[model samples]
Target: MKWNPQDIETFLQSKEYVDTAVLPLLPVAFDSEMGQAAGMSEFITLVTGQLERQFKGRLLLLPGFSYLKTCEEEKLFTDLLLWESQLKESGFSHIFYLTSDLFWKSAESRLDGSLIWIPSIPLETMQEAQKISVVESQVKQMLTLFTGKWHEKE
Candidate 1:
């Protein structure tokens, strides 16, 4: 479920079943890497949207957690851990952090939740049909990872 009034209502009604939450980790850069930051955001947004649709009733798709690309690593991790703590306290059993950023990979072991990192694919140049195809393909791959994680808990 997307984070909105209506979805939040539905989620509250069915809170027990929606045990997972997906948070997109987006990077923002105002300098020369602006284009790269935009691409990462776009790619992750599309992929996470598709993922949420696929498992609509089972998970909540929270807003992207945006951070400056130049932010201090220690600060970023601390902030992210806070998010995880809050989500757990709110009753989400599985929290997934989706991102195209490689930095998270190094810190994965420190996180209580799972971190999914997919390389960004620039979709600005693709046709509408191509874009849909690519996003669907990526979501298909993620389906396996998500299900595997769910099964592990079972």
Candidate 2:
């Protein structure tokens, strides 16, 4: 569920079933075209919203991790591992890191969480129906990844 007040209240009451957390690792480069960045953010949000809806009770959608352009990669990588450990200690067994950032693909092995990498589609240029279709397809792939992780314990 999204990190709103209502959802968080519900999550508190049913914390036992909410074993997974979805964290979006978004890169915000100031040098990039504003419109392109906005479109990328929108596409990521769309897929994330759908994923939350599909697994509402089992997932807590955290705010996106906004990676700034000026940050050091080593520092960011260390911070991510720290976040993973803290989340696990707080009772989330499965921490899924979702992103369209190609850099994460190569760094996945070093990360302490599951990584869901998808190619970024320019949502601003897509038609309404096309956007829906793309989001749906991406959601399905995410579901498969989540399901695999869920069943790993069994």
Best-performing candidate as measured by lDDT: 1
Please list the residue runs of candidate 1 whose C-alpha ends up more than 4 Å from where it truly belongs after superposition: none
Root-mean-square deviation of each candidate, in angstroms? Answer: 0.6, 1.5
Clashes of each: 0, 0
* Worst 10-residue lDDT window, candidate 1: 145-154
The digit string of per-residue lDDT tens for model 1 on 9-109 reads 99999999999999999999999999999999999999999999999999999999999999999999999999999999999889999999998999999
Over 87-114, each residue of candidate 2 has an lDDT whose tens digit, in order, gives 9998998999988777788889997789
Native-to-model Cα distance after best TM-score fit, residue 111 in candidate 2, in Å:
1.5
Candidate 2 TM-score, C-alpha based: 0.92
Report residue 113 deviation for candidate 2 (angstroms).
0.9
> For model 1, what is the error of residue 36's alpha carbon versus the real structure, in angstroms, after optimal superposition?
0.3
In order, candidate lDDTs are 0.96, 0.85
State, as a TM-score between 0 and 1, how close model 1 is to the true structure.
0.98
